[model samples]
Target: MVQKYQSPVRVYKFPFEMVMAAYEKRFPTCPLIPVFLGSEVLSESASADGSTHVIERSCKLSVDAPRLLKKIAGVECVFFIQKNTLSWRDRTLLIEAHNETFASRVTVLETCSYSVHPDNESWTCFEQCASLDIKSFFGFENTVEKIAMKQYTANIKRGKEVIEYYLSELMSEGITEIPRWVPPAERSSPSKAASPPAAPSSEMPAAALAHQSPRLQMVSWGPDKLDADYIERYLGRLTPMQESCLIQLRGWLQETHKVKIPKDEHILRFLRARDFHIEKAKEMLCQSLTWRKQFQVDYILETWKPPSGLEEYYAGGWHHHDREGRPLYVLRLGQMDTKGLVKALGEEALLRQVLSINEEGQKRCEENTKIFGRPITSWTCLVDLEGLNMRHLWRPGVKALLRIIEVVEANYPETLGRLLIVRAPRVFPVLWTLVSPFINENTRQKFLVYSGNNYQGSGGLIDYIDKEIIPDFLGGDCLCQVPEGGQVPKSYYLTEELENLDHIRLWAETIYQSAQVSKGAPHEIMIEIVESSSVITWDFDILKGDMVFNIFHSKRTPQAVKREVSSSVPAVNNEQLIDRSWVLGVDYSIVESPLTCREGESIQGSHITRWPGIYILQWRACGPTHARVDEVLSSLQGSAPKCKVMYYTEVLASHDFRGSMTSLESCHSRFSQISVTTTSSSQSQDGSLISR
Candidate 1:
């Protein structure tokens, strides 16, 4: 975005970022020798009644902006930047000028510091422009900028290694540096490489720069005048180069994320964001990235398989996890489980079930109600919830949570003053498990339930409710009372069941889960087997980190590199299953022009530039190639842009080595042809099949 100078503007932007942004804006794709003066935040101070801040004594390089501007204009050159190292206060004007006769033209500074106040002084000082030495400022600033650019260039070399290694592993083709990186002395000069100046006129067509919203000021980029948000999305808005880099780094995501930048983008958005603000460098990677699996994640709470008996307890019932699914946030209802607790808070069924009453089973679930004055809709899907820990940024710790709340209020105004808490037993377990895969390990272990209240402690929401009243909430005893199996005994019904409390609760929540689809990560996937529906859930995530997260999410189909290893492959033991099937994902990845291979002692430049060789596939639903599907995938791997294979079914929690690769693959296939659809629940089945 550019600014139309109503006046030959001499304004300096704050937050110290405009220095670089200003140059880029004014020059726009033109090669300019950007000179840096000093490392400091230069704030133009203001008198109490001032309309604008002046270049004050507090500024690092104190030359007045107006005087600096006139000098460059007098030179009759199109120099994009001017900076100073000393104030006109020293009876000297520190100044530097770019000789725009050529791009990266032969340049030098004309220092004019005369009666220089010593560097260390106790008093405020100001020397007029005519009485000051300005050339020295240019010299010092240029030297610093050159040194910094050199360091930055060196770091880029180091980064190249990572990109090359991954890319060479796949494409095997040599990665080369872009020609502009070399210094003029070492590089082919303009005679060899065209470093021509870009069009100076802003009257160029919108397409010449890029499409812009009518509201966006696109004439020039004045760092001072530009909002921070505008700066953030500015780079994204740039065409060709930006879009091209996206295709390389993001691959298939280009269609959906075609850079719909927001208005008034953040000027310093990249500082605390990914890569420490090295976005300029990252965009120029040489190779495609490599990812372990074709990671598939759907945003929107979809997979609607609610825990047995809890489906009816939610607001949205068990809407299949989909982009448009309505939300159903689970609230773990809890209270103390002591004998007398039920008599007070629990219903009569408490006396019959297990001689005990639990709020999870006793309480009536109010579907999508504004209970506690909060609007929360828990979406249900038959998802295989591994886990969720708020420790991850999304569901962070209390401190982070508080910050999130504040952000919500500040950014999402409508959500302000709303207290969001989950206060239901069935709700808490799902919330914890859903967020588990994304959080840190410690956070995963400490995953807390959404019990809706503000009291704090270690246990799940039940623990919070337990202390509040004989809270009819819940846990297992500390004795070595391990169930027959070592896992948490989710199969046992420990709540009051006599008065049909469990049955009633089930009927209510099932109706709730049947509500709507949400546009969030699908939390569950369920398939029916007779009257019982088996549920599997998927967690959605966009890795916001460099390297690990980047590669993990990038995908490349094996369309270019097919292998015949699925069949003729022996069955896998539990451990092998972890690595070969679920871990490796049944599909194969492609190694591009540069064949992925083992390295030798001799050095080869094949891994020269690419960061990684990953290619993302935009797939909606898919699963591993079944034994029958295997033959099809094998034949089509390198032929089709995409291939869907079929596999036999196997029990996969433990071992798939029983010669039933079909069954094993079934357990871990990309998609089980998984209906993930709602069906007539077995609430009316003969046996009480629901697990409390």
Candidate 2:
């Protein structure tokens, strides 16, 4: 494996010309860097106008390694080739270097640059990147790799110091500044010839220019900018390649997605998530951007409002900072009634609250970054699962939990720095087993679970959290403000009428479809499942009358059979299913038994496919009052009973859903005073087998 290192940009409060002059003093030999033995120029060239200079040299350095390893390698000093390109007019210097001693067994390459700051012409900026690739190292590849990385990082940190040392030496000798290069044509020849050499004055060095005899205003950096100094001071250090990835990705977004570009920290997280793979990070970032736009999630913090009941029973709130300065969130999952919360506030409301929490987390991260004087992009969540029981594992509640997880993992990748689960009861494992598959592996790795009093000792909560801020309920000094998760009163639930309005609002604001299924001709949706073992989840609610739902599979592909266009409704015409040439047993079979759904009752379910083929979901209206021929005739002629269904379906790959929550399907329904039943048909052995 190859190892790489990147250094954050460092700034010098001096002119580029003066910095370059100081940089040159380090060549030949430097006592400060004992490893840098010396360098001899191999070739040198200058532009016609003397504005650009290029120099190449053969450099030698003493390898700092264990004596035994050095003896095994039979080498004491390593050679490297260095190339320097200086553009005097542009005030920039580029340096490239590569190792020569281990040309065949190992390869090390490094690049560095010094240039004038973009916003301040007087200041200079320096950046560096290096990589080491070792193919064979006499069975000590790991040792060599580690040694190489340590050396590289050490050199990077000392680089800025070495330059500063040279600058100080020059200031001590009164060579505080160097005149800028000027072409012969640009100089005033007569005035230059008549000018007299002035005597040097005993003045303070340029470093003290910002202060007067007493004192003046300090040269403080503005918060809005992310220059070299700002990055080194606030954001954590990044490797050169990592910096390159950030710069390139940010540039790409600026060119392609000008208006909705994400913050630099946001982009950096994605790059880290993919180990700085530029293309993979870019792709993931773009998808997240699209998801955010489609769902209008960017404004969730400003738009979403939690129901009143949730505030008192949610059992979650922001707490004090963790050991690493990450914002802390305390969630008392055990005390809170998951099922009750879902009942009082619909799935959408619950999801919105979660999103709002995430948005607020992002905001808090920014504030903490300033307060803590470091980058703190992700928050730590301490989940208290002491009272967790089987009720928290209700299927609907679990499904809701999975849905929220999926959406968060997609949009808020890497926002969770750590997850501390305390007092995890026995039932917690069951819940973990059910929802862990839906969580990202990277996220799962962050979870730290504790069974009981074990969390109070070494290698527990105290390792990451300060004991002073620990909740009093958990044997700490501070009193926590988070609610105690409790059962929400059933009476607080809205009436059926108001609940129906919420469901209607969901359908009205989304792309999900609503279709009316009449008697005799059932409404069927055909989906082509190309892979077997995948999950197909469906959620639908009967808005008006009752209906029957059934799923069937067919190996034979359906041919396009067009019929007279209906002016009222358009649907796929599948009348050919009854053709004599089509065999029910061999071509198609019912995969699920007909299930009756009453009006006002929401239904959500999933099926695992056993075979790769096309599947059909059908819904038909069926009223219960068909006792005799007279009643049947009257019902058929009166209004041709119809059922309204609003539904959404999704197909997810098995691997994606493994150890993670699959996409959940949920519905909201309110029924009137109508009873319904599915029509009974002859039970076929094939249908029974498929259904099983």
Candidate 3:
């Protein structure tokens, strides 16, 4: 496996010319870097106008490896070829380097660039990326890769320090700036002549300038680049390699899942959860993203309203901040009647309540981060287990609790900063045994349990939470608004109401709808447009087999088909809107070109209606149309090829089209708009499968 690294943009509050001069001083030899032995120029060239310079050098470096490994490799030092291309006209420098020793066995490539900051003319920005590939290393490939990556990351900060040292040296010598390069003809012009340099007495101290905090340059990096200062200020500090993994994973998402990309803080959480393993983090994050989309989790705070019974009986609610500024949630688990609540509102209602709490907790965290002026990505939960007992561990309730734990662990990794359990009963151990295995190891370490009166004194709640804000029930003065849960009345039990509730239907109350597209019997919907030029927008994810999508406009409406329904099973609308006897062009004309969608791909697009009538959106399975009757019959008898799609569509008036366009563009849809002209046949648009 090849290892890669990317460094966030580092800004120097100095002109590009001065930064370039300091960078050049690092050549020949730099005592600050012990491993950098020396470098000799192989070739040098400059343009006639002195606006462009190119240099190639052979650098020698001592490898910091174990003695046994060095002896086995029969090498003490390695060589690398460094090439620099300086464009004074563009105010940029590009550096490329590659290892020379063991080129066939192991490959190391690095690229670095220094350019003028986009927003600040006086500032210079630096960025770097490198990759290491070890094909064969005498049965020590893994060890070599680990050692090489460790050394590389350890030197990342050192490289910046070296540049700062050179910069300080130059400043101490009264060289505060370097004149920009110019053509001979322009240099002679009085208007084009450079101004006199600033005096040394007017400049700040070199040491102070070198040690100052680096400012974040306000550059338009779009959504791809992550600023170092932003990361530190918003997502907390991360190692160089951790930052690289975050950037790489985010870049992959931007490339594949363009719509609804999670925030940087959210992405960082996944990276931390996986210990910065790119592939593992990517897999975990992709699964969570899909879950969020399928269940409409992103809008839970807005869409989910807990039942009145749950609001009054649920034992959990947000309180105040902990000592570390984390949002604190007080859950009176011991006092709450778990069995009564589950029996009253059903397990699905309880699960939805929990999800809403999590969503609200995350929002509170963001708000607290701004209020506290620090990064608060997780929250603290204080469980008042004074009333916990065997009744709380009822079989059905335990099963429901386990399911909730599994969902939260998989989707909300690393969100719990601390879990404080106070006044635990003797039976708490039994409950813990049933659920602790489902919790993540990282999260489990944050659990703090205190039984009996052990939580009152030092090294207890006071150490993590403020004394005054402790709930009144916990012997503190502050009053908590969390619902005082009790045994629900028998009249509230939803026995008959929940007996036939489908698990899938619990989360199916979303704006999106699912359809099954099979061979010949295509799934489609009809949209009635009363005004021309109105916008018809559609977003859908192909969840199964490959299928083709097309839009057709008809002057006449198709009759709705009424089918027999089974009371036990919910209906799946897979009806074909277009009749089989109707001809393609006569009955309905294709308004947009056909788009071939593959499994796991999400497609969003819009079309402006040229005429008012009916629009049919269709998804048909893709396969050979000439299969033999017997072969098709045999396949159908066994398992027919089918496609599943989750889709949502909306129509906007002509006046509303302009207002919604911004949102449509921001979604990064593959097909932003479709031309109204009809095509002879459908063609597949460029699309990528959702990353797993």
Candidate 4:
């Protein structure tokens, strides 16, 4: 402890612990410089630099030595305590006294690197330690309490004085350089070097939020140290796998409806790991939209809801990282909270999280007689009619479904309508009910008959495929008849069937180019005819999850060929009706939490998916919300450009596949959509591969 000095500008020293403690109590909200003991920027490996010769690394910095001292004399606004709770009146005298003697050439830097002013007792020790060249430094310790009766009065006084000192210094030099400390830039602040820059607020509404993608806000902390602050910034480029995943999502919902899109920010797209980092995956997503729409943004939306109290944000803060982080970069989506909803919905109806519909699914719990008779569901009845296209009808269907839920739920226990999950025909929800009970489930299958079909001329097609899709080889229909119960003629090509035959079709290099053109049939995935009309057979099971389509034509009769195959293979429910309940233009889901791919181990069943191939569609959410739908479309794009139907279902839990074993390449020739030989892991209990 230093003795009282006679001169003005007194200096004092206090324990670092005492300093921090006083500051927290004094300036709770005000940003104050930390007067830490032996505090220096940590090395990349978190190692301490041997800069501190005084404070020991064990408890705090060396008390008397240079443990916390890097400069001989640098001014800093740090917690100054004479020692062990000195009175404020005494501190004033000490500060005044110190300015008069024993020091020279002081350079006051930005923040306090170390407690800047040490009193005489500490000064003597510092001088002696340096003069005596004491490497194994030893000094007396003092338990001190740094106290400040008035809070912001202390830190604010310091900050203001520092500003005044700088302004005066500039005037003395007859020079002018704008000081960086002041808020001259703007209202928003930049995040850490590793974080996405937060966008500033816009003067207008949806001004910035309308055009920003949601992807910018997502910040992925690596599972290990490898994605550390320094490494990820440079090395984490989009991998090929990530690029492919993106390519698929870009095309998945080229025709989704806007109504089905989630209005809630959190429920939008996801930041996926394992398969590919969401950011890397989005690179391709952005380029995908460039091919379709002339106007597009570079960034996507990313939001993070910190565990309460960590971040000063609710529903988290929405900011766009790619679009020059500005208020113009933020996109706002409605927030959803389930807690207050049930009451607002009125107790007359039941609250449902999801709903399912199918012929068998309609009988889940006997309707009109069950406890909650006729459970509140999304649809009055799942419609299985013939109508518009899946690509075009998807959004309209969602709007219709939401409207149906809102309209009918008025009197019954179905008034609360928050979400609607769509799938082709009635199977999705039927498949949905057994898995999810909180949602509306229809066990008694019933659908309103819809005469929505307008396609009369060329089978189910509405018109000549758009110019964007018109194929080169297979336009004009050839009037050729096949014998009843015979195979389809070889001349008839089904592009979707071959391309999306299985996930392996992803191997086809030409697939990415599909975004620009429509398809006819797979010339690559074909079975040739022989001297004698040979029966080259393939079952629909191979193409069950319609990710790919199976278009086949034989010299003989497709009718005869199909009849023979029908006797041997049970048909998967491939979409037949045009009015099936599929979203066309817009489809989206609310992602309530960070999707846990790890928790997916509980699902025992693997539901059948007709769409075997995955495709992606990307669009800017509302505006500045950088949202790209990582949607899975019928990998059949190269197969059936005009097909009005598409379907998909995730059968196995993510862990079931040690790694994605989708033979997307061999999909063309093999009739099997799923390889029976491929095991979920090197060793699996179920031999889960679908046996053909």
lDDT of 2 by residue, 133-158 (tens): 67677888777766665555445556
Clashes of 1: 149
lDDT, candidate 4, equals 0.21
Question: Each model's TM-score?
Answer: 0.22, 0.58, 0.83, 0.17
Candidate 3 residue lDDT tens string, 450-512: 999888779999999899898999988899999888878778887664744735558667778
The stretch of ten residues in a row with the least summed lDDT in candidate 1 is 599-608
Which digits, one per residue and each the tens of the lDDT, describe model 1 over residues 1-692?
11111111112211111121121233222222122212222333433322222221111111112345326424322221233332212222233222222123222221111122243232111211110011222333344333323332332223223323433332333322112112335445666753312211110011111011011121221222222123223322322222222222232222212222111112112111222323432321110010101110011023222333222221111111112122212222122222222222233222121111111111111222223332222222111111223222223223323432332222211111111243333445554455444443422332332433333345433332233321222222212111111112233334445324643542233211111111111111111122121111221112121110000112322222123344654222100001123223334331112111111100011001112223221111123312233443343333323211111111112122344323322342221121122122312211111000
Ranking by TM-score: 3, 2, 1, 4
Q: Candidate 2, which ten residues in sequence have the lowest lDDT sum?
A: 203-212
Q: What is the C-alpha lDDT of each candidate?
A: 0.23, 0.68, 0.74, 0.21
What local lDDT score does residue 649 receive in model 4, on the 0 to 100 scale? 23
How high a TM-score does candidate 3 get? 0.83
Q: For model 3, what is the alpha-carbon lDDT of residue 408?
A: 91
Q: Give the alpha carbon lDDT tens digit for every residue of 616-663 in model 4.
A: 211111112221111112222224332111112223433344443343
